[model samples]
Target: MTDIRWTLKSKAETSHVNNLAWDLQVSDEIANLLCQRGIKTFDEARAFFRPNLKDLHNPFLMKDMDSAVARINKAISCGENILVFGDYDVDGTTAVALVSSYLMQFTSNVATYIPDRYVEGYGLSIQGIDFADDNNVSLIIALDCGIKSIEEVAYAARKGIDFIICDHHRPGEQLPEAIAVLDPKRQDCHYPYDELCGCGVGFKLIQALAHGRGQNIEDLLPFLDLVATAIAADIVPVTGENRVLAYFGLEVLNSKPRPGIYALMTFQKKREMTLGDVVFIIAPRINAAGRIRHGQHAVNLLTESDYKNATILAREIEDFNSDRRELDQLIKDEALTQILEKQEEKRFTTVVFNENWHKGVIGIVASRLIETYYRPTLVFTKSGDKLAASARSVKGFDVYNALEACAEYIEQFGGHKYAAGLTLTEAQYPMFKERFEEVVSKTIDPNLLIPEILIDDEIPLSSITPKFYRILKQIAPFGPGNLQPVFISRNVYEIGQAKCVGKDESHLRAVFQQDGSDRFVSIGFGLGKKLDLLANQKRVDIVYSIDENEWNGSVSLQLRIRDIRPSSMG
Candidate 1:
């Protein structure tokens, strides 16, 4: 299960050419990728490469938006108490920060509440509502969650409190009875884009606020840094309007980062930041708050009014993230053992459980199992009388829908297409597991069980140039659907080979020559095991991403090697 082989499939160039000819000003390979991604016209290509805030659809276009905005405006005007309730993940924390900070400008009555990860679980809870009521809060804004909380929203509504739901998760057949349920996934929603993260949706709310106040939208552009971080961290597709948000968000992240980000950058030694930097360095720190403790730590860090406090909180979060990494690795190792022991079944799904596994890290563990096994995975741990589990799906399988099939056993569940969370009674775990496996075995194509590494395009090593790399960089803030361009070169000769080292000789550095004309340096992290295969072969094919690497204060263009194999002898 750990050594799943990835196969490369190359589509004919004609189809790619036909797809890109109308829009891209590039060679056939780049155009093919653009076309394959449905960028068919010049305008579409332009917008895809350069996302702007101006391109974000009017927020008022969402169903119930008018009511949501009016209620918020009334609260601001009347000086009524308002509470912002959010989940405990990065997306939830950023959404809470976006809405609460925006509202603080008009009224001090606004305060934020983040559910304790260990104590309260996710979304709007009756306890949260009662707390808001006790504080005399008349308005509640639920961010990043609450799409499926029909009961909780109804309870809050009955208490003479109004609710506004700004969420991105898929809603159930019956929508919540909140005053305004603003979700793009709503069947009636006509918003042009449907792939926003929770924080991205929150950004739209702020955008609407700016428009209502007749304020310049540019004034809110700085906040894109946070939106971009959430979009990247939440694993949302960075295409369409999200691309624009993350594109501008990265610029703000690198140029004029707020205190929280600045402190994180300094701590991580990330002098120059990119979307990848945010994904790898900054995001884990932000997420560590919810994983190891309460997400309020993250919210406080994001909205820190004092510079000194922000620095202290950033360092504290970094330590927490480090601890989380250790815990995640430990749990992942243990879960892998449990999975391997049951590999004889050859099943299409993996469901592993343990009594004492940390509830906070089950999601992370499930994600790791998915990467290794390339199957729909669920990691469950005992929680009270029920078993709480986190589920992750492969490319074609929808874990949320799969969970719905077993809803008879599930006490509660919510998440996106790829990731979800659920709770079920301990007595029903075995039956639900068998039913889930049966459902997946019947529905999933057997071939998709193997992980596939999709190469964006095939290219000649000679085709790579500074100009081409520059064009590629313009498609910044790559994530999920909009990925950093990957290129495959065939029949490449190994000019030189050595295990250039980092973090315990874990990386391999080498030089490659194609057609005996062009030589390129390539570095493969954790590919030292392939050193012998690379050295013995005279030539090989490589999958790589073009990058500029800075080493010891020197910069040079190089290939970040992804995978390689012997050249086809045929």
Candidate 2:
């Protein structure tokens, strides 16, 4: 529906692709896509296609793992009350659910804590420490957050409570003085795989404990469903160990999901769950508890053992999700209107603020703005005395670094290259906005402003055989590092009458053939306005990902169209 550049991915080694294709007995297209992902040899391809649990790196390899495990073991032996604390978002709540449940297996003294998004803000909050201290908890296991909570960690220490942190966010220059700080991203850490999400990190800790207890890895299979959801929700790279976790996690998710997950899945049709389904369908509902209510509700539901109770909680969370959706859409429209009213559409970055905006959906609103404005975006709302903002960046640009350049205006901020959050006084908002725009304008690569799609390969309709699709489908659990392949097909002709569908008539449905050799059904969501490309029997080019479409209880291969335009060569 919008202009986009289609670029072929960087070519892989030619000899390697041909040799691998011969060995694998598949098309060169599949081999090339694999090679581009750094899969060269047969062994590498084998491991990639079939991830083994034994392939997972030793849990003890992560820095401070022994210390963290030792402390947790000591607490369980001493019958100490342990507090599990995490952020309010999906990664955090999932981590809390995982670690708290795992610890509960050894002792019943474990308590899970999720900070109030509105009241306590983010990370290791002082109020959470106070709660831990009041409850006679002697140890606190912080998950997903606490990497940058130096003061709060010290605060917990002063209260005679030891801290063990399991986090995946990038560490600050100074590490917290906790009893154990388990973060793969730390500079001194020697963990082989650093891309684990918060829940993945939590998974490693429990894996270490189970090893100490002489528990077989099979005992941990039930927990994979939670790890997979966190990995999907956190948007971590789906390569290396992460893929293995996601693979097995999805297996558990489909086979024997927890009561909480099973309850949530009642809304989805009975089918295998993918990373996309977790991201769009499940994560938001989990996040909605924290956004619209208290994050503790999410932790409650995730750890609920009874299916009927979980269903009751799931029904409540669904209402929260519905409220979240309305808030997101309404805030997005308001933010867009603010941008246009301010005459700032031509700016290098989007900075919009509304004191009346709901703090929960500002991040979603910031993301929606980028789709319309196609630039770095920040959405701000009033948070008590100061103004809190959620920041999102365009592809290939580091919004975190841009915020760093304007650090003088920010009270505190943390996040990755693409997403971040910050707070500042209302008085400094204008300067921060101006300085952020200037920083991004000077530093961002000019080409990153335009959206682009990386095409894996160009192929004719005949290349898509049933066997080919069957093998291609093995590349499951796709995310950032490893993504579902998109292909470009040129000189394709429409074979049937095209029609606009959907409630808004914004969807395109048609059948196309190449050289009259094959006619495959295709559906392009949000491409109805471009139906002119098929008029007068004009040949057109298309960018699409292959998918299975189910209609009338029958399933067939279909091209999920990404974009379509008149053939450039013809």
The candidate scoring highest on lDDT is 2
lDDT of each: 0.84, 0.91
Count of steric clashes across candidates, in order: 1, 0
Q: Write the per-residue lDDT of candidate 2 for residues 334-439, one digit (tens) a residue.
A: 8888888999988999999999999988888888888898899999999999999999998889898899899999999998888999999999999999999899
Candidate 1: tens digits of C-alpha lDDT, residues 1-570: 424344544654685576565446587766776666777678778777767667878888888888888999999999999999988888889889988998888889988999876667778888899999999999999999999898898898889899999999888889888889889999999998988988888888888888889887789977888898998888888877888888888888889888888899988888778878888898888989888888999999998867788999998998889889898898898887877787733778889899788887898888888777788999999877778999999987788888888889888998977899998888999999999998888888876787766777777888888777887777666788877877788888787655657878778898888874567788998777778877788878888888997889887789998877888742
Deviating ranges (above 4 Å) for candidate 1: 2-25, 341-345
Listed in order, each prediction's TM-score against the native is 0.95, 0.98
Lowest-sum lDDT 10-residue window in model 2: 266-275
With candidate 1 superimposed using the best TM-score fit, by how many Å does residue 372's alpha carbon deviate from the native?
A: 2.8
User: Which candidate should be chosen as best, given TM-score against the real structure?
Assistant: 2
The whole-model C-alpha lDDT of candidate 1 against the native structure comes to 0.84
